[model samples]
Target: MVEESAPDRTTVATVTRNTASTITAKFQADNSEPVENKNTWGYVNVTEVTDALQDTAAHDVCAPFNAPVPNYRAPHRRTIQVKCYEYIWLIKYREQTILKNEACKRHRLNLPKDVNPPSGERYTYQGEFPHMGIIGWKDKEGDYIFMCAGSLISAKFVITAAHCTNLRDPSVEKPTPDIVRFGDRSIVPEAADAEFTVESKIHRIIIHPVPNYRELYRFRLTE
Candidate 1:
């Protein structure tokens, strides 16, 4: 206690840094006889006041995933991994190095670089023998029966054998050749390029006028 009187009291306190302290003072009153009053006290100094935090948070943090590098190759369909637990289909395109008969050279993989392509008589590709036409006949069931093959000489006419146009079958009218389909590779089962084929009606058949050619198979043009 610095200054204490009968009715009042005063006290001063000092605190050091990085330490804790407290202040207290005594009070008294001049009564009829010896008397005492309320005492005053207060907390002093301080430890520290701040949020509970860390300068650098420490935990298990995974980095982001990166796309895998691609290994370039020829045209094909393959699977690709885009993300974790995710996959996708990828189609790569390249030059046309395969014939229609051989969809790919996978059979000859790892072969010599200077080796020739798979050797076989391949003919049924696009734009191959485009002038060839199919000579068919409509039967009683409205189905076209492929009879013979012809060649298209012009846009409106096809050249075929006269015997193909004859109703040789013993039925009422044994399916005479009356239809010609051009720009086709298959006739019965319909090839993959069937949608691009052109079909036309036979307006008339003209057989060349030759002596003794009535029963003989000869070339004829149908308009």
Candidate 2:
């Protein structure tokens, strides 16, 4: 049987700080600062990257599959390829995971189980919980509605129930909240209100894996 060659593909690697300026200059001249184009997928020459890193410790870490370690593989001989967006996604995932873990460790709150006793209801909360907030949205008729509550988990992220997000009902459909109001108690603001409310536009919404809410609703209604 005759020996066959591997399929040729270009795999991109992270740009080094030394050549970043040069690359940026080139892109600036071309008038394209890494703009995503659905028509054409971008690629990088992995062989060039491997050859450059051959003498460095990085070559051993990211060497392509079926390639020998501590050696430079010629550009024509390497055939591994990866999409540019996929590589970006992996980097973002790693960075976000790190941030999430750090946030978890910093805000691991532990309180007594009997924090709230069976006392009579109280009307006022004197800024006891600064992180608590009210999530609000505007309906199609330009009406402000307070649907659910959320907690400020981080400076950029708000932890809230999944039901607060986009929802659909047999009779009515509702979009996700457009803004989050913090430190606001009254859903309807009054002229006599003294509390300060901070409103911020939501960038993203992450829903947690939960049991079927419909089943729970049915069970509750029957009970």
- The digit string of per-residue lDDT tens for model 2 on 78-184 reads 32223343354444444444433333223332324344313894323334467776766776666556767778766777776656675553222356676677665
State each model's CA lDDT, in order.
0.45, 0.48
For residue 38, what is the lDDT in candidate 1? 17
Using TM-score as the measure, the top candidate is 1
Worst 10 residues of 2 by lDDT: 214-223
Clashes of each: 0, 0
| Candidate 1 Cα misplacement greater than 4 A, ranges | 1-122, 170-175, 190-192, 211-223
Each candidate's TM vs. the true structure?
Answer: 0.41, 0.36
What's the lDDT for candidate 2?
0.48
Worst 10 residues of 1 by lDDT: 48-57
Error (Å) of candidate 1 at residue 96 is 5.8
lDDT of 1 by residue, 1-223 (tens): 6985553223222223112221112112322332211121122111111111111111111111122323422122123212211211111111111221233222224334465544884435445688888877777776776768777777676776666667576532354676787776555443324656777777776666662333333233444
